[model samples]
Target: MLVPSKIQTMFAAFYVCLVFWCLDSAAGAELAPPRNVTMVTLNTQYTLCWDWDHTGNVTFTTQHIARYKLNSKKKSPIWSTVCKDILDRSCDLTLLNLYYLGIHVLRVRASVNGRHSDWVQKEFSPDKDAALGPPTNVILTPAGSDLEVTIFDPLSSNNSSMKELIPTLAYHIMYWERSVDSQASQTHQTLTSSINIVILPNLKPWTWYCVIVQSRYDYYNKGSNFTSPHCMQTEGATPWWEIFLYFLGSLVTCFLVMFPSVYSSFWCYKTLKATLFPSHQLPMHFKEFFGTSPGSDVPCLLTPESESELLCDNVTVRLEPAILEVHDLPPENLPAPLLGLKPGSSAQHSRHDSSSSGDSGVYSTGGRSNSQQPNTSQPIAGVIDCWNGLDAEQVKMQEMALVLNSRPKIPADEGIVDMCV
Candidate 1:
């Protein structure tokens, strides 16, 4: 009985030890897998990363491993290890041999001691995943009435290897006017070769437009997120030449409107200046001779008989003797006596007097007697004869002198004349 009891106790202790070991092993295999796994690219290099969950009260001694397989193949895929026994949650996958345009399945697992958690799997394509990055150096420029947009390809760490994955790239563009009642429009364009320039036409002139762009591969309908909104304005419809012409026309119109008024003002100013300050005046000698006062009057005692005798001092003729001689003439010779001539001086006059002696003696200056009279009988007969023989200019000068001499002049005082004498 003692021996049997000993065997049973031994069995019970062994079984309990086995059961605890199994429970520890199972618990070790239940470590949480990597969370939030993501792929990041940086210029011909690729990296995989994940989050470490340390949220529970239980502590874990954890390590990571990453593996990949081609999803396109039907046969059992051979999984290649990207990283093993790594303390870091991230692994570099740039050294892995990848196929062009191949759909890939990637997995990451966390291990505690010798046991691993369930795998966290992700499906990836280098073409689609690499294009998730936004394009670089996007710019907008004005091209006449249109808008020109330029963008470079999105940067990728595995660009060289992924080039064959997406042989062609397509661009999706979205644009709209920045107005209250504007609607956005979209356009898609495919390019076999990389061309950074694009022209958008039929835009409103001088209007502000906002635009965004994204890239995608032809095989994959998925595209990258649109870039940050870029805003620019379209150029105006009017040409520079037409604007210059309008400015020139305005200048001409202004000149035309102002020229006449300017000229008229200048002319009026000149006339006013001339009227206010006269440039010419009469000589001082003439002013003194004419007397300063315009209304002065003086008595005249001298009568001039001819232009040459205007300023004579001596005067001995007697008007009474001449009148007495004129009254002595006979009534039959009265007509001839009035002309200061004796009767019967000529046969023509003597015949006229004899015929008119029996009739009343009525003298007529325009009769035949007057016509036949000699020019020497008048007081100024010699002067008249000399004037008639002169030229027209000399005749005019002589007549002007006679008129000036015939004016009544103020006589000098008798005492002053006597003193001169």
Candidate 2:
């Protein structure tokens, strides 16, 4: 119903009224500046905090903003925002550009609907206000008779608070023997960089020790609180007496293990030697009677019957033929004449005996019949032909061979011997 220009002018006046109402509302709702601004170091991070007045009846929708500037006089101070839209009362300083050993000014304020409160400012030095944090990843281990400790600096990272402030770090180590009424010992070591590991030497062996570590900034002269106490034990040194006993036990064990083999080898060697090179000496009485001369003759005693005549008068005849029974003969005894006969001759004699046994009244060389004629014209020798060219050892061996071959084998159940022809 209104004209176009009138309508346009009315809309513009309404817009201006709305704008002024917004400005007045914003001015009335402006937030109060934060108070008691403080900076504190926690672990490896720096935090800024301030107190807010929540006691007023007026309700305000507010947010906090933090900014920092370097405390340099010549350089144009350009403030850098640390954090924005912060509903909490604290802001982390790790997000800011920190300068080492340089002064800084930090400001924080509250904002409500684009209207800002007065900024609360504080001056601080990175070195003076910076606090070192406790060492992390602390470990203790035994190093022979000593103790080895390893730790990592909390401020060694790029985002740490004290990294720029502290040029060098020093460690204070406190240790004591874990016993009643024992005094504690302290050691100090300054390192240009992070101390990754350290060794405490000259410690008591096989002893328990309690230890604690703390770190300090060289420029700030502030030290962190001591870490949790750690307990460790050093390895024991082996005693000389125990080492000697161990050696002796080893030697005894080796001897016990090798003794059986050594003894068995010695016995085997002795047996082989005896078999290969046996003693060849006769008895004392026989030694005197048997001469060593090559051609010397020795009289041998013989057994004969009354009808038997000795061709040599120097030979003695102590045994009677009746006393020399076949059963009484030695197991090694063989026919005396067969020793000089060849295999062919012996076989021929055997065939002749088999063919003319009744008429010839003879037998094989192994034995003779009673009707066989004796060779009285033949001279009796002391030793038989079987032993003529052989030594005593050879003769013994030959006798053993014959005995083994001709020996009678008895059955397990039968006691009587079975003589083999």
Candidate 3:
């Protein structure tokens, strides 16, 4: 193909222009400023800090690390102060008064020309490191049956952006009743308020109360009376359960001391009645026993002769033997007779009687007299023989249809028998 020389030369020039434009754009991109540079006030003397990065071989001076505090209006530049050599760092301002009080606005500008870079205005306060004077705007509120009061730092007004501006306080709340002369006593009533300084005014109910909120740091509130009125009342009196518990304890102690003997006596009586009187049904002699006069049922103790007389029912023996064998008698079989003898009777009787009759082979006399012997104590052989003899006598009496023998034996010396011729 045949190309014109003018066309080739124009093409070559256009290509050179394109290459230069590309190179220039790359250089411009490399020279762009760092983004989001910021300034922070660390304290009263500290004005501002930066959050910035270096680019394209810029020296620290060229990066404009020092922050300048401009005029309040921010129109004029006070001298550009160098805080540090780092591009991302804090700056100390020589103009300390500018940040001493009130809110301060600081702007950090980056300028290599000393003409002051565009100002980055930031608003902040100085570090409150100094000892706080005292609390102000103190308030007292009445909590239920208690007094509560609080004191706030005066500087807390503007530092709302910062945290925890409440002042550290050493305060006490005291109350005193006014005397007749309007004088207050030093020995006043006191209450412990909550730790929080904001809620300090409260008291017990039904009392005329007042509170004095005082701090050791020379803080004062002149407008306050320095003593809050007593607002006091007592909670309800002690509970009924406590009184009941006290009485119940006393009653239990008394019962513990007395109940054992009483219970034991009752138990013994019931056991004796149940054992000795096994017949639950009333006795046939109940009417007679209950109706009889006193002493009618007096217990009787009789001698053997008397018992024999009663048993024999008017049958008189010529001679009543005195010696009675008692060896065969069990202890229980011993009769109630001869018991409870007076000392005089014991001295005269020697507790036994001698017998005139000789000993029978079937029964041995144990040197005991029937007069002194127990009525129930008798030899088994004698008892059995007596029972048989009585049985035979009963048969004879039944045949005779009489209670006595026909001869009825008259006194031997007094009678003479007449013989029939």
Report lDDT (CA) for all predictions.
0.58, 0.61, 0.42
Local distance difference test, candidate 3: 0.42
Ordered from best to worst TM-score, the candidate numbers read 2, 1, 3
Using all chains and alpha carbons, the TM-scores for the candidates as numbered come to: 0.40, 0.42, 0.26
- lDDT by residue for model 2 (1-421), tens: 5699899999999999999999999768756888888888654357788888764332212222222324346766666677776677788876554654566677887776566677777876655786667777579899999988887666533655344455477677777667655464444332332565888777889998777788876554688898898888898878999999999999999999999999999999999988888777666567446644344466444457623765655767684212111121343555453356443222111113576444232112223232233333443233345467656675544443332323232233333333333
Per-candidate clashes come to 4, 0, 36
Which candidate model has the greater TM-score, 1 or 3? 1
What lDDT score is found at residue 377 in candidate 2? 43
Give each prediction's root-mean-square deviation over alpha carbons: 24.2, 22.8, 22.4
How far does residue 152 in candidate 2 sit from its true spot (Å)?
2.7
Q: Give candidate 2 misplaced runs (Cα > 4 Å).
A: 1-31, 42-44, 55-78, 113-115, 157-165, 180-196, 239-421
- lDDT for model 2, please: 0.61
Ranking by lDDT: 2, 1, 3
Candidate 1 matches the true fold with a TM-score of 0.40
